[model samples]
Target: MGQFYCLHCDRYFANSTVRDEHFKTKRHKKRMKQMSGPAPHTQLDAELAAGMVGKARAPDCRGTLGAVEGLPFIFLLM
Candidate 1:
């Protein structure tokens, strides 16, 4: 396993020296900036998810789910 890890970048670094260099990279900076924004869940999204409470409103599976770029995994209750 790597000694240093960057959560936003989802990468591991062998050492602090390499990790510091990675942190200063434009790619890492761009990724960090992108990850620091607000979530996409709007009122409509909340309303849709809330439907899980009632089986009548629930879809055959989960109601239409959304996929955003860059997210490795996400689970929304619905």
Candidate 2:
């Protein structure tokens, strides 16, 4: 006898037969539908979009600030 785990429902079944039956349940179907959709944005994402968060600096190449062969030497140092 082995246990079967359902990730969506967070429940365990005695066997694959029971687990397969659980997958056909309305609760499991609803959970699947909810998980299939795109995730909602969080407050941090909203702040970043609104420019409230500090903006990231753009890569500076232009053969300046120790750029070797068009690639930043700082990256190689890392």
Candidate 3:
């Protein structure tokens, strides 16, 4: 769970010897190859991509969702 954990393979070994052996396995190699590509998106990533949330929201500018579509200006409130 601590030192001998394989993040890409998501597996654990009893000791370093077994873990080292696991690193030489075809399945582990394949998993490492797959992980070498683009990383998978998380829930926060999905939300940001879909405009559900972001780093910071302006005082008046809201999302073009549910109500606004082609609106030119945003409504400001006091």
Q: Which candidate is the best by TM-score?
A: 1
Compute the lDDT for candidate 3. 0.68
User: Candidate 3 regions off by >4 Å?
Assistant: 1-3, 40-45, 54-78
Return model 2's CA RMSD, one decimal: 12.7
Clash count for candidate 2 is 0
Candidate 2: tens digits of C-alpha lDDT, residues 9-78: 8888998898999999999999988888866755554554465654353234232232123553333553
lDDT of 1 by residue, 2-21 (tens): 97999989999999999999
lDDT of 2 at 76: 50
Give the winner by lDDT.
1
Residue-level lDDT for 68 in candidate 1: 38
What lDDT tens digits, residue by residue, belong to model 3 across residues 1-78? Answer: 546888888887778999998889999999889989765655544564577774484334354322333465545898
Worst 10 residues of 3 by lDDT: 58-67
Cα-based TM-score, every candidate: 0.57, 0.52, 0.52
In model 2, the worst 10-residue window by lDDT is: 58-67
Candidate 1 vs candidate 3: which has greater lDDT? 1
